[model samples]
Target chain A: MKITFPHLGNVYFAAKALFDELGIEYVVPPLSNKEALEIGTLYSPEEICLPFKIMIGNYIKSIENGADTIIITGSCGPCRFGEYCELQMNILKKLNKNVDFIVMDVPSDIGIKEIFNRVGKISSNSSKSKKEKIKALVKALKIINMIDEIEADAHYIAGYEKNSGDSKRLLNKCKRDAINSKSADEMINILSEYKRKINFIEIDKERKPLKIAIIGEIYTIIEPFSNLYIEDKLMDYGVSSKRTLSPSWWVKNTALSPLKINSLDIKKASKRYLSLCIGGHARECVGEAVIAKNEGFDGAIQIFPMGCMPEIVSKAILPTVSKDLNIPIMSLIVDEMTGEAGYITRIEAFIDLLERRRKSVLFRS
Target chain B: MYYLGVDVGSVSTDIVLLDKSLNVVEELYLKTKGRPIQVIQESFKILKSKYDDKQITASGVTGSGRNIASFLIGADAVKNEITAHAVAALNIDKEVSTIIEIGGQDSKIIILRDGIVIDFAMNTVCAAGTGSFLDRQAERLEIPIEEFGDYALRAKSTVRIAGRCAVFAESDMIHKQQLGYKQEDIIKGLCEALVRNYLNNVAKGKEIIQKVFFQGGVAANKGMKAAFENALGFEVCVPAHYNMMGAIGAAILASEAVKKDEGTKFRGFNIAQSNIIASSFECDGCPNRCEVIKLEENGIIIGCFGDRCGKHSGKIAV
Candidate 1:
């Protein structure tokens, strides 16, 4: 079986490592771009969210590349994401593209045995021994964690880099080197070397840069193409930005959720605002905003797709959060029709607000 | 010597010339009519007839078409309308605390505290609460846009109209017209409805403190001014150069940038006669198919942009 999956930021890198080490055939669809969006928009229902449309594009592109199996994670939450698989399957079937789907749901929802059965569907295609397959999984996990750490460090150091664009240049190079590695071990080595290089980059501690936290829908915030590469723009503007939601964070949260030990800080921070899991990481978005203020961030930006129910609730609560915490938060809604000019204007104005606020506060002191 | 500012907006292109004392010496507001380059070139020709290009020290461009306008004129400073508007307002009145700027295709609320902008919000993906919608409605009613505001002032009692969407607002107006409401009352209701929509959407959750300066092309509408007063329960100050504030701000910013940079990048007013051609083509390098814009002057490529990968865009120097 040639496995295929939708793009979600850096998850594909780990997926590549896992499938490579497993000796299993897989097709990695080209990076999300205009073509994928056009194909997705052509087939998706008019009112569905942005992520669903992009995922459909990924599936079709993979199908074109001779892939016969699709592996996707399933969720049974209050959010519309839970119903994505069923609707997508029907859409693909109507298009006459017959492909097998292996959904890996959480153990709590589908039971551990069912989870393994789904996993075995893909592993059965690989001739590797059970121990070797487990090693591959472990290596993939390490790769994700390392890459996330390296990315986080680069973002934070961007504001303080003595030489402008140093961190960004290094980070881009690291990704290029990591993705080009022939094996998982080579990728890990490249990641670690870049991580050290990023840490050692000359930084100007005296330079006070505007710091922002990115919080919102998982798909919009994690996927760069979906949000028009806001993080890249921030880096270019010499702003330090952080986001608590990432593939590694999602993996850790899922694994430790049943034990009631996952994201304790976020849970506590968000308790006063959103205590319940309304699904689709709305609670995490709220929590991250509160934490951003406590962590001395200058401001926060929340991004979500248009008509996102959970984020709409979070959007309503964010102004209160901004007022209560005395932190500035700007929410940007994106869809297929989002204009770049308007988006850039908002971001620039937000940054100007933050910069002027710092000056006025410093003047008072 | 004078400083020049140009605001190339979606609906109109505004140009301003400020003397050494920072007072506006001349200003021109011309409809863009879907041709920004021609409008800019025409404005430059007019300015050239009056003053020598060497008399201008620096130039700046703003609004949605700032990038292209800046490149076309060799602007020293290229700034967004928000910053340009804020700078212009703050320059005009230090005590101004709120700015309600409604322009063509975009409306924004900028909240300032202590002469510094603290917060701002712009209308999202919708032109319902903008000058363009009002212009369209005025056109549909066969009333001169400048006189539409006066018609609103002539109304005896306001009628209720939905202003959430432009299409709905137009249909509601038609429905109200069919029901025998006076033309002035329907217009007055539209003015009020647009004010309500602007407050609830663009300026949502914003604290509108007094010394509120109303600016932009829509500021010319007396009915909008009255509606804003009725909604906010305070006097709204409209600057003398309300329609050209973005351009004025651009000029002020360009002057400031010139002081630091010690030289202007302006190509001179003679550029109006230059053989400049702007065109675009679909890049076939990848699946992105980015429509790369290429600018040529007398058959020599001057600049290229709009490519995501920078493969085509990097070929030309700014």
Candidate 2:
């Protein structure tokens, strides 16, 4: 059985590592691009959010490349994402692209035994011994954390690097080397080496760069293509950006959620504005904005897909946060029809506003 | 010597020549007619008729077509319309707190505190409250666009029109016309509806204080200015050169940019007679199918852009 999965940033790296170690045949669909979005848009419901359409495109592309098993995480939350699996399955069936779907829900939602049963369905196809399979899972976990750390450091240091583009160049090379590694251990080594190198890059401590926190929907924030590679754009502009969400963070949050100690800092930060979980990381988005302000970030940018219900709530509340915290915040909504020129203009104007606030005597009382 | 500024927008191409002291020396506003290149060259031809190219110190470009316009004219400074507009407004009056800009295809609200731009918002995913919609409504009513404001001013009573969407607004206008409303009153209603839409949508949640400046092509509509004043319950200041403020700002910026330079990057007025072409092709290198735009000058490929990969974005050596 050839397995496939949608792209969610570096999650594909972990999936590749696990599948390779398990001796499972898998087809990694091409990176999310225009063709995938076009196909997905043609088949998806008109009102569905951007991530769903992109996922549909990924599935179709994989199906064309001989993938029969599709695995995706499921949520039982109040968000429309909870119904995505059923809708996608029906759509694929209608298109006559037959494939098996393995939904990995949280242990509390699906029960531990049921979760393992679902997991065993995939592991059963592997020829590896039980111990080696466990080892592979552990390595995949390590790979995700390492990659996330490398990416975070690269983004932050880009603003301080004495030589412009050093961090970005190294970061790109690191991702390329990690992907091209023959084994998971080799990938880990390459990642560690690059992490060390990025830290040692020459930085002028006296130089102050605009620090922006990226807070928004998980799918849009984690997936670069969905948000039109905003983080990369920020890096190119020599702005330090931080995002609290990542695949590793999700893994840890899911594991600790049952213990009721997951993301306690974020919950406490978000308590004043949003006291309840409105679902789909709305609370997390609010919390991150507050956290960014408290951490002395210059501004925050909230990016989400058009028609995103949860983010719409966050967008409404963010103006208040911006007023109270005295931190500038900009909300960018991305859809398939999002024009690049308008998007760039908004970003440029926001940056100009921030810079003028710092340097211009016009703001002096 | 003069610093030149060009604003190539969707509907009009505006050029302004500023003296060394930043006074407006000459101004020209020409219809774009969907051909910015031709309009820009025509402006240069007009400039050449009056003064030598050597008399120009520097040049800057702004508006929606700033990139291509800058490339063609060899501008010393290129900036987005928001910064240019804010700069021009601040230059006119430092105490200006709010800028309501309604251009041909888009509208924006810029808020300033203590002469510094603090917050701003632009119309997103909709063109319901811009000059283009107003022009279309005037055309549908068989009224000259320049006389649209005069018609609104002559209205005996106000009529309510939907301002949520352009399509709905048109249908509502027709519905009102069918219900026997006077043409002038309907035009007045449209002006008010558009102002309401702009305030609610583009300027939503913005803290607009005193010394508000209204600019852009729509600012030419006296009815719009009056509607803004009536709605906000205060006078909305429209600058004398409101329509060409973007070009004025661009010229001011160019003068500042060339302060340390040996000379201006102005390609000279002779470029008006040069052959320049912009063409695009769907790149087949990847599935992205990016429409790569290539610019040529005198049969030589000058530059290529819009490709995600760097493969085709480089300048081809002559």
Candidate 3:
């Protein structure tokens, strides 16, 4: 059976590598874009969040491409995202699309046996032995971690690269080459080579570029298309940017969160502002902003889709954080109607303010 | 030398000229009326007739139509309305702690501490407490927009008007009028309602400190200013050039941005005669289908933007 899943930043690379290793036929739906949003909005409920609509569009596109089995991860948070899977399934059923869903909830929530059963549906298709199957999973995990590392390196080093756009060019070329690789091993090898190459790129040591932390909704922060490729824009401005949320980070955080041992520092940092998981990544967003200030970041930009309930709460709380930390924070609320020019103008103004603040005599260190 | 600043809003286009020390030397306010380009050119023509183009060292654009205006005038610095307002307010009063800027289409509250922006909030996806709403209500009441504030000031007592939305406010006003309320009372009630909406939404959770400054097109309404003061229990100072503050701030920023050696990018007054064509086309290269906007100067493409992927924007220099 041809399987498919919605895009989530670099998670597609890991999924592709795993499917390729397992010899499972799968369709990776095209990247989320205006067409997907239009289709999704047309079919979705008026008040539902942006990510839900985008995912629905991805499903329909994959279904049209002959994907009969859909794999989706599940969550039980207070955020509306947890409810998306059920609603999406109903929508597909109503549309008369013939597809089977394999939802992989946390083992604790769905039970270990059920988790294995869902995973086994796909692994069962592979003729490889148990050892090879385990190795393939390991390889996929390694690839995701490496890719995230490479991305973080490239984003940070873009500011200090001796040659302008060197890091950006390398990052783009690496992704393109990896995606074109025929085999999983080749893809992994390509990523590792690029990962090593990123470390060797010549970087200027004397440059004092602005360092900013990106904090907000996980989906909007990770997905370049959602945030209008803000990180790339920051790179172009010769500004160092760092985001704590990544596909690999999500995996690790989810795994260790049930044990009450995940992201202790973020939890501690956010305790003063938001102690509880107010559903979604509001706590993380707040925690990251505070941590960013302490880490010597010049400023932070918080981006979330318009009308995101959890992020709205975070937006209200961010002003207090900005005041207490004495760090400039700008919250950009984006929707389908968001004008690109206005959005860029705000970013440029924020950068201009940061530069002036840095050079001002009053705030000298 | 002079620095020019242009503030292009939905309802008005304001242009200001500032000397090297940033003193406002000349200013013009005109109705935008859905035509930013023509209004800007008209303002430039008036300025060119009075001042020498060679003396204008640099130019900046701000407000909603900043991008289009910047492209049209070749502004050295392009800024958002928020920053421009805050800068202009601080310039007026170094100790200004709060700025309530209610413009044609949007409203914003800037909270400052020690001459720096500490926190701020703007009205979200609503136009209930802005100048356009007042203009519409004035037209419906057959009152000239300029005299609407005077009518509110003449009221002895106010009648309740829902200010949460323009629709509800209009219906409430009509309902009050039917209940035998005077037009003056209804106008006053509307002003109070708009202020209530602004305080609850835009200025919610913000500390209303002393030395508050109110600047924007809506600041011209003494009734609204009185409503703000009455609500906050503090005096709100409306700058002399309240409506032109954005333009003044843009000029200040431009003066700071351009160095003597670097020179200015101002396209010159002759650009007013050039045929600037703006058009958009959807790029089918990807699923994004980004509707890229292109601006041509006398048939040659000068600027292209709006592509999420820099496919088209990268090719165009500006």
Q: After superposition, how far is residue A329 of candidate 1 from its true place, in Å?
A: 1.2
Residues A44-126 of candidate 3 have per-residue lDDT tens digits of 88888778888888898898899999998888888888888899889899999989999888987888998888888989998
lDDT digits (tens) for residues A188-227 of candidate 1: 9999899889878999999888999999999999988899
Which regions of candidate 3 are displaced past 4 Å? A162-164, A361-365, B161-183, B315-318
Q: What is the TM-score, restricted to chain A, for candidate 3? A: 0.96
Interface RMSD of each: 6.5, 7.0, 6.2
Clashes of 1: 0
- Clashing residue pairs for model 3: none
Q: Model 3 chain A: which ten-residue window has the lowest total lDDT?
A: A356-365
* Span of ten consecutive residues with least summed lDDT in model 2 chain A: A356-365
> Model 2 — TM-score against the truth?
0.95
Per-model CA lDDT versus the true structure: 0.89, 0.88, 0.86
Query: For residues B97-132, what per-residue lDDT tens digits would candidate 1 score against the true structure?
Result: 999999998999999989988888888757897999
Candidate 3 lDDT for residue B248: 95
By lDDT, highest first, what's the ranking? 1, 2, 3
Across residues B94-152, which tens digit of lDDT does each residue of candidate 2 receive? 99999999999879999988888899988877789799999888888888999999999
> Could you give me the TM-score of model 3 versus the true structure?
0.92
